[model samples]
Target: MIVVLSAVLLFGANIAQAEEPLYVSVGQTTGNLYGLYTTSNEMWAVATQRCKDLGWKNLVFIKSADVTSEVYDLMYEAVGTAYYWSPIIGMNDLDNEGRWLWNDGTPVSGYTNWGPSQPDNHRKEDCAALEWPFNTWNDIDCGREQPFICFQEPSEYKRSQIDDRLFSIRKFDVEKGTQEMARSGCKKDGFRLAVVDSDAVIAKIEKSINWNSKVGYWVDGTHNCLNADNCEGSTSYVCEDVFPLVLSNSREDYTVGNTIEIECAGSGVSTVNVKWQRQDGVPTDNIWNEPLQKIEPGKATLIIKSATLEDSAKYKCSAANDIFSPSRGYVTSINITVHPEAIKDAMSP
Candidate 1:
């Protein structure tokens, strides 16, 4: 019975292993044996054999499905050990220096494995490596580029079709209610307002009104009337589609203890409400009780006598009216830092 049970367990493990799919090999290049891998969908069997003949170990395979087609194509063109002397390019090494950075210039935190004292800065080495036993990196000289392996895998392509019968209605010249337009416009587009086909148009119109109009109004696209003859002027408008809401001015960043001025602007917008609150940690209830100052119709200013670390948070400005929903609401954040007297004195008064 013990022998039979052991055999059963071994068979089960083999089955599980077989279920795992084999990854594809796309290309091979040489560098400082940086273990970084990328993908392409195609395989190059000849290149794999050549690497084996060259006694190259630690082959890194890149799965094509894991990356964009453009990247895959680049790897496919460079198959074999001939490119071994060339630099092994990874997403983080685009600009070299071994410091992997995102396209946005943000330093990629974590995901680093380096050999102890490996980057020893020997003679200003800038290239990096992914060490074995653990995939870590150490900066090395680019001149020491070595060979690397790449892989690709097949993927499925699934295309979805959308209905083409949908149409859109846009306000051209004046403020129009979004709710009314959505209801009336869907019928002409051969769909209902509830359908997904109308969501884009509805969102566009709502954002426009929310950013542009101070007065709230409802647009019913389902309305069939040619003009405002049947529409309720007090609650709705048959006005032509116009530009969406726009910010009156640019936003400026501030530190604690600094006064801030916020402005909201749009064609039909007037009064705006300004609210300030903390972004994280405990919320303060007394902020509202402080005397709020209004600078002008659609403008407000907050004066911080002496800003504190607790003052760091986000401020919101919303402009609205009865004819339309809040036309525009803008958010700006402030960061506070406690500067030492020496640093503060260094600044020009």
Candidate 2:
């Protein structure tokens, strides 16, 4: 009767509703159409309207499991070739400007987004991936090991586990100086040199030691310019920090009459000294003997009275101060070439 018919209809409707697949709403469209994708873990949905507006043509799912069969094939197909290594898309690569492009040589415009400073070319790493919330792309190195996302065909009962953890370093302002000077600056800030590896730390320390002055001594946390062992345990003020030094407006080749000016500075120290030396000249005993004008607190100017090809050799600048316990120094060598014309001109004058 009527009661029996009502029960049948109600049960049928319940079964129909249960059979309908659940789709995740990524965004939405104006109409009933929902942009959807199914993966082993999650069903994602995007509004049709938003998809159309953003020009997003497809749903990219980062498959967490068995990516080898699904996304890997897509990557190979997209590149029109097979790769020896499994391709992963994620943060580091995205920061480095690595991207996935269609085999037809057109950019896949709407698929990628990236975080700031992402894909920095750290040691030439390149690859790109999409991260969540921001939905941005990060460029990374292919050889680097990291997690990845994968997409799969539609099916019901899919769910996504989003990783909300963000691994990042706090941004801070760095005082500008040479590598040595910068290290001292860091120490002043309660930090040591920002080297990631032991080898780099050793190399930096050794370089600082080798460039120390002959008469200078190392202070606690300061660089001992003189390669003296007696002061290994004794603390004294000396130049040993790694700071960057640059020489401007100096010619590679020098001759009689070529005027050379040298300047140096660092984050912590002020006042730099410039000296000129001849490698193999008449005064072999007086190699470091040239008396030069000292610029107060950071710079010195040295002018070669007359240009001569023999004036070419190594020029040294020793920069030091008492700002940090251990001071710092940097050395740069330039090959000087004196043109014959300048030599002849000097001879005539």
Full-model lDDT for every candidate: 0.32, 0.33
Q: Write the per-residue lDDT of candidate 2 for residues 181-287, one digit (tens) a residue.
A: 53454455323333322333333333322233442233233332223544333222222223344455556655446665554333322333333333332222232
**Per-residue lDDT of model 1, residues 1-349, tens digit only:** 0000000001111211122111121111211111122222112233233333322332333223222222222332223113222323232343655565532355545443345775466776644433321223455454553443422212211011011111122332334445555455433322333322244433433332223243323344443332233433333322221112234444343444555443333232222333333323221222223324444544444455555555544443322222221111223323334333345445535
What is the TM-score (0 to 1) of candidate 2? 0.26
Give me the candidate number with maximum lDDT. Answer: 2
**Model 1 deviation from native, Cα RMSD in Å:** 21.7
The C-alpha local distance difference test score for the whole of candidate 2 amounts to: 0.33
- Candidate 2 shows a clash count of 73
Clashes found in each candidate (C-alpha, N, C closer than 3 A)? 56, 73
Using TM-score, give the best candidate's number.
2
Report residue 195 deviation for candidate 2 (angstroms).
Answer: 14
The whole-model C-alpha lDDT of candidate 1 against the native structure comes to: 0.32
Lowest lDDT block of 10, candidate 1: 1-10
